[model samples]
Target: MQKLATFIRGDLVYDGSLVSDATLQERFQSSIDPEVVASPPLLGPKGIPQFRKLDFTRDPRLAGVQNPTLVLWGTEDKVNRPSGARSLQRRMPNCDVHLFSKTGHWVQWERADEFNAMVVAFLAEDSADALDFRRV
Candidate 1:
C-alpha cells in the first residue's frame, strides 16, 4: 500500500516538481482509505497478458466511429504519448484535440477549471464542429 501511494504521488507531478501541497495531502488521505486501498490487483496472470496484447494502432475500427469525439492529452504525460491524440484526431472524422503543455497524465486533476470548461462547451455543442486544436 505504501509503495502504491508513493508511486501515485510521484506520478501525479511532472519531473523534478510537485503538485500543490493540498493535492498531495488529499492524495495521501485517499490512499490510506480502506476502500481505496482494497481494490483487487490489476495485473492478474491472465489480465497481464491481455493488457500486453492490446494495441489500438493495430485496430481498424477506430476509423468507423461516427460520433463526435474530444481528445484531451497532456504533452508531459508519461503514460500515453501525445502522438496518440494526433493519431485519433486523424482517424476520427469529428474529433477535437486539446494538448495541455507542462501537464502530466492527470490533466483533469491538474487543470480542473480549464478541463471542466472545455468539457461543458463540448457537451453543449450541437453539431460536428471543426477540429478545435489548442494548447492550454
Candidate 2:
C-alpha cells in the first residue's frame, strides 16, 4: 500500500485510512451501486475477469503523479487518514495537502463546496500561469 501510494501517476493525496469509518462502512455495505458483488447479467455477458476489472483498486502510485497535485483528507476519515494524504504528498513532485478536521474518505462528496472551490482555484491559478502538464 505504501509503495503504491508513493509511486503512482496523477493528482492525489496520501489520505490514509487508519481504520474503516463506521458510516462509510455502513454505506459501503449498503451501497446502491456496489460493484464487487456480481450481478447475473454482467457476469454472464462479460465474465468474471471483466467484472473484477471494474474494481477501482489500481496502483496508488497512479494517483501519486507529478502533476499539480492536491491532497485533501478528512481528519475524521477512519479508512483514509491524514497519513494517507501525507504519503501521497511525499510521492508527488509538487503537492498541496488540505486536511478537513471533521470529514472522512468521502471528503469530496461531504465537503463538495470547499472541494469545488479548491479545484477551481487550482485550475484558475494554473491557467493564469499557463502551467501546462500536457506538454511534458
In candidate 2, position 63 carries an lDDT of 58
Indicate the residue-level lDDT of 61 in model 1: 82
lDDT of candidate 2 over 26-112, digit per residue (tens): 444553444545542233228777754543333456455766877778876655446767766666768888998767666776677
The lDDT of each candidate is 0.71, 0.60
Local error of candidate 1 at 22, Å?
5.7
Model 2 misses residue 30 by how many Å?
Answer: 11
Model 1 clash pairs? none
With candidate 2 superimposed using the best TM-score fit, by how many Å does residue 119's alpha carbon deviate from the native?
Answer: 0.9
